[model samples]
Target: MTAAFTVRVQDEIAEKLDRIAALSDRSRANLAAQAIEDYVAREEWQLAEIQAGIDEADRGEFASANELASVVAKYVKAARQA
Candidate 1:
C-alpha cells in the first residue's frame, strides 16, 4: 500500500520532470517513484562498498591515511596535467 503526498518543486525542475514523464510514457508520479527507487538502490550499494572496505581493513588489507593521501595526490597531479 502507498500513501499520497504533495510536494512543491522548483518551476524548472517540475517542467523537466513533466517532459521526462511524457517521453517515458509514464505518469509524473511513476517517474518520480522510479527515480527515488534508483537513488535508494545506489545509496545502498555505496554503503555496501564502504562496509566492504572496512572489513578489508579489519583483515589488515589497508593503507594508512597518510599513504592514501599521497596516492590521491598523485592522481590529482596526473588529472591536472590531463
Candidate 2:
C-alpha cells in the first residue's frame, strides 16, 4: 500500500534533486521518497536511543567521575597525538 502527499521545496533544492534524478536515471519522486525514508529512519533511531538513555538515568545508571575522567583523558590524549 502507498499514500500520496504534497511537499514544497525551495527552487534550488528542487533543481538539485532533478539533476541527481537525471544523472541516476531515477524519477524525482523515487529519490525524494528514498531520502525521506532514510531521514525518518535516522530520526526514529535517534529518538529511541535518547529515550533509552533517559530511562537508564531514571534508574540511576550513570558514569562515575572516574569513568568520565577516563573517557575525557582518552579523548584528550588522542587529540594531542593528532
The top-ranked prediction according to lDDT is: 2
| Residue 72 C-alpha lDDT in model 1 | 100
What is the C-alpha local distance difference test score of candidate 2?
0.99
lDDT of each residue in 1-82, candidate 2, tens digit only: 9989998999999999999999999999999999999999999999999999999999999999999999999999999999
lDDT of each: 0.93, 0.99
TM values, all candidates:
0.65, 0.95
Q: Cα deviation in Å at residue 7, candidate 1? A: 4.0
What alpha-carbon RMSD in Å does predicted model 1 have with respect to the real structure? 4.0
Model 2 misplaced stretches (Cα beyond 4 Å): none
Highest TM-score: which candidate? 2
